[model samples]
Target: MAPTPCITVDHLTVNYRDVQALRNIRLTVQPGKVVGIFGPNGAGKSTLIKAMLGLMPVVTGRVSYGEGTLARQLDRVAYVPQRSQIDWTFPATVWDVVMMGRVKKTGWFNRFSAVSRRLATEALERVGMLEFRDRPIGALSGGQQQRVFLARALAQQAEIFFFDEPFVGVDQKTEAVLFKIFQELAAAGSIVMVVNHDLGESITHFDQLILLNKELIAAGPRDRVLTRDNMTRAYGGHVGFFGHVA
Candidate 1:
């Protein structure tokens, strides 16, 4: 595999109006791995990703990819915001939502090329949502909806993928599908970051873990980050659900 630029977060801080959310976060995330951001509620796990993507207001810090800032190279990024943030009532078909991924390259109001259609179709097929392509996105089950979004992200063919709470309402099958594709992306040298809350066996799927609680706690290999001390610092109590930790 060729060398690729790792994601660098330096002295990152975020404030929500008058309240500070994250402070002085610093980490380096390499490609070729599925990185999980784990923390208790209001711990700023999602804030970190949003700050890195420039979606949240950052008071200090820089997220760099290679020689340039990540915000400046967004075309190479794929993001799936939390499900609650999405408007489920939106009247868009599964195919329409998947095709939207090509908008950045195909441009708005322009016809999509055959290649774009092929990519979108293949993405849907990979996610097992091809048969539901014509169904309304709002009408699908929670797992089905999540699969469609995954397909949409796949259609974008991005080098960096950020998922916020993807498994919240998904079924076992959806979770399995997600991890399978995430491993594939990492194997292909793409950066895959997921914001997850579960501390069960599912935690073992991540190659690296980022633990936070309004600030950085630990980050590195799963075993290193999920140490008893690290877990206590991040969760403020004994974590009993994650079986893989020491």
Candidate 2:
């Protein structure tokens, strides 16, 4: 039997008014896999995730989840946007922010019940931010803020997870913690897609790689997809643009 794909994106194209962000992107990811999206700047890495979550306007093609589609199953998906996009100065407690994930399931105008609060606290604990539940979100460091956002996503309890630059400014220890949580999510048969920029670490961390440069460059196991040829192809003569990190 063919493995069930948690996500199937077929010949999808995304446009941002005058700019064509993503072009003819076809991808299928099985459940329980940690897929990494990589390329240099303007590669449409975040655009792809936004398209899948129905946050970006698609000029053409289809994006489906299982046999249905993303639009019909929005509640089953969780999105963690890049930390830089959020307004951290907003008046919100750590617990308040995490509880917001439950808003979709519990509808607006409804207060979070005990069960929702418990789940939110547990997620905070899982990400090592439980101690700061009552603290103001703006008071936390960059890494802590990221973890709070992740805990919020976790509180969503969705089957498919999409994280955009979750490791952007986090420390190695925090990155490891997030990776372990990702592994646990996949182990429980949930798909975890991370939009990442650390090219060197991509080879060692992800189960599968999705290379993009305004088009589908390659999609397969990390070892097969991260070769020098594909690297050069996706990066296009700029493979050595950044110093290699040991």
* Candidate 2 C-alpha error for residue 97, in Å: 0.6
Cα displacement (angstroms), candidate 2, residue 2, comes to 15
lDDT against the true structure, per candidate, is 0.91, 0.85
lDDT of each residue in 1-246, candidate 2, tens digit only: 344466889999999989999999998987788888888889999899888888877999888977788878988888888877889889999999999999976776653788788899899999999999999999998789889988988998888888999998888888888988988988888889998888654347788989999999899888778777778889887464222422
* Root-mean-square deviation of every model: 1.5, 2.9
The TM-score, computed over Cα atoms with residue i paired to residue i, of candidate 1 is 0.96
Q: TM-score winner among the candidates? A: 1
Q: Given candidate 1, what's the lDDT at residue 222?
A: 92
TM-score of each model, paired residue for residue: 0.96, 0.93
